[model samples]
Target chain A: MRPDRPTADEMLEAVEEFLRDKVMPAVTGHLNFHARVAANVIASVRREIGQSPYIEADQRERLMQLLGHDGDWETLNRELCEDIRAGKTDLDDPALLEHLRQVAVENLGVDNPKYSAYARLKE
Target chain B: MAGGSIDAALEAATRKYLSATGIADLKRLSAGASQETWSFDAPTADGLQELILRRAPGGVPESRSTAIGQVREARLIQICHSHGVKAPNVRYVLQPEDGLGVGFVMDRVAGETLAPRVLRDDLYADARTKMAGQSGEAAASIHNVPMGELDFLEEITPLQQWQNTWNAYEKYFLEWSPSPVFDYALRWLKERVPARDRVTLVHGDFRNGNIIWGPEGLRTILDWEIAHFGDPMEDLAWICINSWRFGNIDKPVGGFGRREDMFEGYEKVSGIKVDPERVKFWEIFGSLRWGITCRSMAFTHLTGHDRSVERPAIGRRSSECEADLMILLGRN
Candidate 1:
């Protein structure tokens, strides 16, 4: 006898129902540990999806265009990360900080007052 | 209990306790990085009651407590509560025979202690007005706590505290990452260590997040794990650290009120004027201390004892401490 195959949405619904009803109830040892497990699972999924070359190339192009950078995007990201890790580049650096502010505003789809204030501080 | 193995032990303990008093439902609460906190519902023959249980994880830093055992923490909490400090009322200390490892049960107070919400929530919009007044009063109350009354507390000379902290940081750095920034900060700190004026019972983690705020105002001060005998200014300086200021760097006291207001509040109650220069010295120490703590967390992850993204994120916050160093050194 063959087993029935569920649609994608149905499978997702079934998994959600199982987690809410059966799985979560049994795993009550430590709340923080359980939350960490859930977060790690989600993070792993995000990492797997983020590793696609097409997605990476698209993200890089978007970032470079936003920053108005002609150099390689990966190198720019590495430099930015290094700068942030060290105390050398303040989040208040004018040109780069302004570009970051614009990106955040556009991504969030809101004219956030906090970002505006942050941009002004950078200036 | 869903897990049947521990159920028998729980039942046995419950029965033993029930002979004296009824044991209500046990609900596990949020555990901190090193401790497990649980809310125990205790029902007497009369009614439902709630108590908090704190248990230590197997491996933790030696600096967390001066003594080797968990009973010391329970005793300290009890002493703090008895001294009229707004702290949890410790009820019972669980011995080793209690099936549960080492732990203590205390009366749980209702309040918010999370940092971000305390800083940004509209519910606490008026916190900016009241925080300085509350912190001042709380600090005065904590400082007024007579050290001689507590037999369990160790008395150390005020000046020895600097050496003790320096030694702890040195050990912590050797165990973790040996960042040059920490070395620079330590060198600067040793040169800048001020003369001690007076020693008081210091709440080593005395800051915005450690205090619980409720509808009744400040209900209880939490986390006495790092409590020690030190200069009173250490508490004041810990409160002024930029990390505890949340995102609002404007207000020095938990980013809620002016430094002058906090000073005036403490001065009025304690009858001792705060030394600005002395507080600044401790404030620098606060940054260095926190930076070391971040490194220790990273060590926990690297050693394969525990792995969490949050730990590494906390390690990344050492840069903030470096920024604080720059600000303190007049380089920013």
Candidate 2:
């Protein structure tokens, strides 16, 4: 990382603040909507950067245990999906269900923390 | 039609078809994935007419096989309207000489189309009470529309629908990343694919956002671009999808009422018994379908087909569907 005063996440925070406070207020119609979306994108990126490492690491370990063998995150995920599609993995496996649910909840946390399902599940 | 203003073409077309002197307030309406909606007022000999023009975006013909296209959408609305469904009356389909491209103009029905407002606004409190029941009645009426008249629509069985959606997801997976949750949901759907009890006209996109309502109740159903022949339960299950609930998770039927209320209204209209199991199957299917749609829309952005910011944002919402799917699968 560069020795910058504003780090990546900090820069994103500043951009999000500008978008919400400066740009959105001045815009109208679709532009206002787009500005809101832009702010949200920045927020999502910040959350993903902060949270995804832990989430993906947890998911990787779970997948390793469930599948009994594993590679990296993408490879293991692809293998699990393939097994599911090809009927190699038992559909009613409790471990599999738990893994899927945990991953979904974790992803939703980064994608949209305010999503109702995630909030309800968190509660 | 490309760069030129559509004012002359619209004026000429209305004059020829509706005997209107001219049109005013030709403003673009908001939020359609593959189509554009424009609201205008026409002054005819009879009176001033509020009309809406729904057309393909940029006058380009919809090449997507999933969409039934604007012409067919107009016809579907017309047919449903004739069957006492709360649908808009199609006034005139634009001709080739009209220079307006592929679309149809219809008499605009005044109502709030925004789902958030319909769900939360004080004015729509009464409407919310009646919406699910009315939605059921509307679905029944739509289903009751003679299938013989809708021969033009594509008939997709439950398995076929699943295959098509899965194929779409697979394409996305190949180009992007595999979603294990989606795969799991698809497998679950395949394992419990509902039988085609009876084939009927399925409003493939029947959800909260596609409906327009007023304080009294449902004024109109909009966006028939994906009308097809499928299991009637698809419509019932579709509206019950958790995503459509818009945070009113307890009120399953479009965030306003119960599934029982909706089923009751449907049964009252069509005299057909509601099958909860079948609806449940389709509800799961609906989540997967929506997830795939979210990913597909995001791919449009990722691939630079349409770089709208909203597209990638929606792509992230695939996780929302995954979360909903996990709940629906009883695994949460």
Candidate 3:
């Protein structure tokens, strides 16, 4: 059990551990190599958060929430994260791609061509 | 490395060049992802001089090399100086083989380049009134850069030759970014790509920040990285882009002068009548282009190449451009 408002570092570390121990090992050999690298990235992100635990925590939380989980996302709360961590998710998936688009637009409240481009990709 | 060691290295470098024609007291300036600017006190044989050293950062965009490099910039400075365009004098360009990496030393022109400071400073209060006249003159002079002399830019198609600048944005976005907004803007832009006008050399990044203003008038025009032979109206539209207005939405053309003034200035020098529709087309394109540029900045942040608050803040400005585009295309 975690606090109602876990720090970004704590969330990041938990996500990293889950990805490494649970997610990475579950992937096929085809994706295992990529998963290992991704795991290292998660570890690096954890190290960065060790320097500043709270900076961009709001943005991080917003990112997690927009990914469809809110509050105390203990370990890779969404299926998309699990798939991404395992390197099993297709980058071309329209739904997942749209989710990424929404996150960018929601975080930065701008309606520029980039957003318009993303919004029209489903068509 | 320790601060003392860096300082010692800087001091040694400064002393090595002290007797040169330009100033040489080097002060470490803030580091940018693409370049590092150093402010230095330069004393020439003639008089005191302020100088700046611009060098590529350890990591820079690969795409940048195709557009403008130090060698090309030096050539542009030479051309501008000969034509009486207010621009910094290029003093020296260190070759790539030189241990300094890609860079040049130039005469540091005085005046505020920052938009907020330009708007707030009392010194420039009256200066704003003269901006229209100065900008007009400067633009005309820039447009008059001898086409025959600029052989390297022969590959750039003139305005009438280009149907859409959107393709450039599309290529950059598809190759570099995962942002979907780029795709959307591409579709919108493609649908509304305007007809071509007469081609002329375009000052690709001509706008407020690029122009230095002094008490007398426009002192220098900087950043010739994107200078290309394209529609002349491209420069006009770029100058009027809302983002360069710097929070001053009412007064376009960098929040200092009217579009008519800029047109009048260019007309006087180029001996060509300004086309209203052509300028309007580029104006819309300018907003679209800048919107894509903002996403590219955001992509840099997202990709973790650089993670500055300024980059993401700039990403937020893309929407302002979208609204502008909507109005331009009559969607709003």
Q: Which candidate model has the greater DockQ, 1 or 3?
A: 3
lDDT of 3: 0.61
- The deviation in Å at residue A101 for candidate 1 is 23
Query: Second chain of candidate 2: TM-score?
Result: 0.96
For each candidate, C-alpha RMSD in Å? 9.3, 1.6, 12.7
Ranking by TM-score: 2, 1, 3
Q: Lowest-scoring 10 consecutive residues by lDDT in candidate 1 chain B?
A: B1-10
DockQ of the two-chain complex in candidate 3: 0.05
Q: Give me the candidate number with maximum DockQ.
A: 2
Per-residue lDDT over A1-123 for candidate 3, one digit per residue giving the tens place of the 0 to 100 score: 344667776777787787688877898753665555455555544544453344235444643644656554333224334444344554445554555444343333323333332233223
Question: TM-scores of the models, in the given order?
Answer: 0.68, 0.97, 0.66
Q: Write the per-residue lDDT of candidate 1 for residues B187-226, one digit (tens) a residue.
A: 5566667766587888778898888886445778887876
CA-lDDT, candidates in order: 0.63, 0.88, 0.61
User: What is the per-residue lDDT of model 2 for residues B60-174, given as tens digits with 9 covering 90 to 100?
Assistant: 7879988998888888888888888888899999878888899999988888878889999999987788888999999999899999988789899988998898889878765
Tens digits of per-residue lDDT for model 3, B1-332: 22122334333343455444433456656465656677777554656767776766631323463366656767877777887777788766655444565666787887878877776688888888778766766777777877787777644543322333455555544354323333443444444455454555567888898888876567888877767776677777788887787666667778777888777877877788888777776787678778767766876787798865456656555656655554354321
Enumerate clash totals for all models, in the order shown.
0, 0, 17
Q: Which of the CAPRI classes, incorrect, acceptable, medium or high, describes model 3?
A: incorrect
